[model samples]
Target: MGRLFMLDVPENTSIVDVARHLDDVTVGRIGPYMVIESGDSVSIDRRSTDVRHAVWYSCVAGIEGWRIAQWDKDALRTEPR
Candidate 1:
């Protein structure tokens, strides 16, 4: 499985929510960051979250061992490095 990390900001709450909806994905917190774990690909729809541009762009604080495969106005995808 791969891990994805996100900052614990108001705009990132939806990220956690969206992550929870996915199967095999677990959401948790580490310090000020939200950690997501998945057995396969992890994806979150940008429009569904309704996060502002600035927040969406900077929501990811750390990668752990993962890299951003797709991150834009459409969605966020993280894969193992």
Candidate 2:
């Protein structure tokens, strides 16, 4: 399984939206944190999220059972660990 945890702020809401839009991905919440889960992997495009640079760079609050495949100003891609 792959998972990413993020702070549930206004700027981060789009992250959850992106995760939920992906096939087979689940979106959950732990207090103020948004948890994104997938049986495979999770990849969220920064552009699609429409967040500014600060939010984009700091959106990932935690990662579990996954590795960052790519993270630039363009996108964030993760793979099963």
Candidate 3:
């Protein structure tokens, strides 16, 4: 399993939406944090989120039990722990 932790800010809310659209992905919260997890991988399509470059460049707050495989203008991809 892999887990991705993001801040529950306006910039990241769209990221959560993209994550939830994926099958088997779970979204949870702890205080101001939005937690996203998946059995295999966790990824989000940047274009679909519609976040501007500034927000998209600095959206992720934290990561747990997962590793960032890719983070560019295209997407954010997390690998299994």
Candidate 4:
């Protein structure tokens, strides 16, 4: 499983919204964190979220069972570790 914990904040709202709508992905709350989980991988397109670079780079609060394979101007992709 690939799990990503994103900080719960206005700057990250779009990212959370996108994650909620993805197939095979689950979104839940853990305190102030928005937990995103998937059995295969966790991938989010940067353009889809419309977040600025500062917000995009700092949105993640934590992660589990995965390693970030891609995080750039294009997308944020994770692979099981």
Candidate with better TM-score, 1 vs 4: 4
Q: What C-alpha RMSD separates each model from the true structure?
A: 1.2, 0.9, 1.1, 0.7
* Candidate 3 residue-wise lDDT at 22: 92
Model 3: per-residue lDDT, tens digit, 1-81? 777778888778987988888999999998889989888876788999999878887888888778899999998998866
Deviating ranges (above 4 Å) for candidate 3: none
Q: How many collisions per candidate?
A: 0, 0, 0, 0
Q: How many clashing pairs in candidate 1?
A: 0
Against the reference, the lDDT scores of all candidates come to 0.84, 0.88, 0.85, 0.92
Off by more than 4 A, model 4: none
For residues 44-76, what per-residue lDDT tens digits would candidate 4 score against the true structure? 999999999999998888999999999998999
Ranking by TM-score: 4, 2, 3, 1
Per-residue lDDT of candidate 1, residues 3-36 (tens digit): 7778887778987898899989989888988888
lDDT for residue 26 in candidate 4, whole number 0-100: 93
TM-score of 1: 0.88
Cα lDDT tens digits, model 2, 19-58, are 7999999999888889999988677888888889898898
Against the true structure, candidate 2 reaches a TM-score of: 0.93
Best-performing candidate as measured by lDDT = 4
lDDT rank order = 4, 2, 3, 1
